[model samples]
Target: MNYEGSGHGLARFLAKARQGQGFTVGALGGSVSIGHGLKRGMRYEQSAYSELNMHRIVFDYLDKLFPAKNGRQIGGDNTKRGANRFVNGAVPAIGSDYFAMCFGHHIPEDVDLVLVDMAINDGFSEKGAESYETLLRHLLALPNRPAVINLQVFALMFQTIATGGDIHQGISSYYDVPTVSLRNLLLPIILQNSSYGISYFDHPPGTTELDREGLGTRHISAKGHGLIGRLTNAFIDMRIRDLVTGLYGAELESRLVPETPREQIRALQRFNTYEAIPAIPPKCLSAHSRSPTLIPSTNKGWFKYLIADQPGSIVSFDFVTAGGLVQLSVYRSHNAGLGTAACWVDDMKDKRVIIEARWDDLVSIGYTVTIANDLEDGDHVLTCELLEETKDPQKKHEFRIIAVIR
Candidate 1:
């Protein structure tokens, strides 16, 4: 959690907040950001079904500390339930590709502060990185240039190999955006067998030793949420205090990031600085992949794509992208019924990639996989065909495409 200068977008929020103006705080990301296992084992007498997430805690603090004199809220209702507006646009299993493709529908336009947490969900992929950059650009290009913070939440998975974090950190550094690292704050404690780290996280029954505690592969416990929330509030309070003290001088914000000497070299070598450009909201072809045309699914949303189990069934899409990245979103789950599909660009069947729909997870989620990258900035056609001929009879023989992102 580094200071992003007095020009931080959040400073505007603090200013408006001090003036008694209504403010809205919004969030977007995957399962962790939305609190998946949060209610499983409640603590401190926390409500089982309450919207008791870390962001919600932040919202509560803002509502009380900076009360709007007019009592105006984004809820637009006379009630105080949603005063000083809070929008939760997070989809549990979706990645940045899907979120950037459908940003307009999810995020509120009048939001003063936006929290984006894609640290763990965006598995290492160039498409994920591009979409994240595009999303940040859109947030920065907003009419008011509302404050956007990149909150990279980490789990025990970081102890192993890379989990799409390096790319995210590099991108954040390049943009010099206001980003926070939960991993940096907590990882060392778990590594050193510290006592506080063990208390902050929950483990299986009677699993006490830190070395034996499987790197937090599961959702963090309620107390973990509380600590993070309190810490975040503390950070915000410090910034608010600075805003009130005239510490944010007229100096311009720094454009480069990762102020270290080695990091500065990497930041300068990059040819294209993605500081310009707006969001590219994709044409969501949910259940229409088989029909070879864009159509609404019976499920009636871009969040879910449905494909029938038929051999040689094909879904085709033609798109033009200046960024030269094509992404395919599909359902990967533990279900045996999910079918496999072959994806290719520009009718080049020779370079097609075989995508297996089955995953070891217990739940079904919209997972984005890169179909093609490093293409020319021109017209391209993407083809996906279902290969249903398998020896397993109980197989679902189904493939779902959440969206086709460019």
Candidate 2:
């Protein structure tokens, strides 16, 4: 059975929709949440996966269940009041390590419902664990008090979920957030021969996009996406019955306990909203000729990762903040053609964190590591230079800087 916890968060959102009120739904995940390879009329547009993915399905269900009435006045006009908005904040090759710091830029703070699909494309490390936890803590501590769901999807070639799921599951349990695992819920259908063909559950033949990743990740077909939508809708329908009968709030309120899992998680929230953090997307410092190589790594994704190939090439950003711990989001890989990055604050060249791109792993992932821990409250220059050589030349010299966060 899927974990619904106290069902309070879901019930609250449902209660608002049942009253014809507007709400904002959001999703944070990897490719599957956005219907990456699923072709819809040979395009990647707003309507591409509008009916297939679960994020859109949740939005569609709310719209159908709560039809607009009387052309309600909203946003200084007669629209958008009873309309529910879904923010699809999923990127193709990103993991929670990227979103854990960059979510504030993508997801609205006033969102009502959040769907998390990080079962795959997740880093299997302690950093991955804390980053995933950081994301949950921040989302749960939001002012709107949205319902968060950990939607565990399956990885095709691996035939298993992310090893990071164990940590994601425990964090979800610690916060009592709703979790629905398709791997756990629909095992029988996924394992045995079903009505759906191979294409339904897999990507097209001869495509090594995910297969060559060494992790065996693949995109779900349109049919597979539809099934996910249906399964999520089933949970919503169950909550709807409770909402109609007034058991939504009453049952949860009556069963409230003093020591709550969610409340405990709230106290431990990360990246204080009140803190004077630096702005996102620090200005590029590379030359005009090199700008093209420094890719803008975003497509509904949170942040960018800049790559430096040649030695003496440096990426720098100046930011002012009431200083605390400083962290840098970068790309890490086990494959070849990666380099080391020398990261540090202004003038403190001796105190720098040398980021190694290659590690003993099978997959490349987004990672965040501390670069500077102590900086006085003032202005500072952060830099990451590509080193000419590294301890391991098997992996080439190419430094990647995802983002610098305080």
Candidate 3:
């Protein structure tokens, strides 16, 4: 039951579970490590074929796209089967969408258990909890969905055997699904094993000094991973079989723990920019009834801001006058579009100057047009063009500008 410090115990559990019945396994997340583990568990005679097909597909694609000689890792006669692998760098931000896409394609209805190990990167940011919740909802909605088991890591566990209950709680609630908090299950073992060199045991097959460092940590080591992979595969397969084996007997499984590329042909459409604030001059600038007067003074500067579709979103416009004077300022509520405008001085810098706007509702959005008279005389140019952000939830538009001064 406790898989943390005892790989043998974990492996034995898996082996025993395989006697229950049969089941389909699907894995997705940071990498192919977890799935490989599951494939190894299957203990099926045909696992080699399945794993080979997956390795071929993944490496072949990688080779064709990035032909670096040293990058290739998956080709050999001993290559395992049922170990398909695909990598999507959408670890943190777009994790919800990534998982959605994976399940939407793989893991058909008949699957008994689906295991996922993700969120290591998501927890690295402030918005990780929110993203995880979204992923949970998507899974719960699947009518034919299998039982879900989410695996995770904790920040502090890297060095000690401490608990990660808080992090695990966040994960469990988000998915509203079952989770195997490995932090709780494996911490003790991992801590104990920390002293031992890598690999399941000493004198491992093809043991090398490097391989002994503890079975590769980040992505799972080649040999150590293979061992864990087989154990996990066996465990999950057994669990699934037991869950559905008897028609009306005590459940064999612990708890019925059941379970598009678009083209770029239309270049015209490629240049399309979805305006955050549709190109429109600030209400103040429009009201002033003058395309911002090109101030020749080096003391004044211009700025603009991009705001998201949230209430209280405000874009601040600033201008600094000659003699270090804070001349004029404007605030535009980001209602529903790409909105921008500029200000200028007549005699400060002796030429036009522009600075992109910074939109921070809480920050003092101010810029010095003069900068202690830093503008050396010559034909100066100032320009600002609004940008349209693509409709991506993760993309944040703070500020940007276009200009040229001669």
Q: Pick the candidate with the highest TM-score.
A: 2
Q: Candidate 1 on 163-203: residue-level lDDT in tens? A: 55557777765655666666667777666765556555555
Q: For each of the candidates, give the backbone clash count.
A: 1, 0, 41
lDDT of 2 at 21: 60
TM-score of 1: 0.71
Greater TM-score among 2 and 3 belongs to 2
Error of 1 at 161 (Å): 6.1
Instruction: Assess every candidate by TM-score.
Output: 0.71, 0.77, 0.35
Model 1, CA-based lDDT: 0.63
**Model 3 agreement with the true structure over 180-228: per-residue lDDT tens digits:** 4434444466567653333432233464432322323323333433443
The candidate that achieves the highest lDDT relative to the unseen native structure? 2
Question: lDDT of all predictions, in order shown?
Answer: 0.63, 0.63, 0.33
Question: Which window of ten consecutive residues has the lowest lDDT sum in model 2?
Answer: 282-291
| lDDT score for candidate 2 against the true structure | 0.63
lDDT accuracy of residue 147 in candidate 1: 73
Regions of model 2 farther than 4 Å from truth: 40-49, 69-82, 156-162, 188-197, 205-217, 249-305, 321-323, 390-396
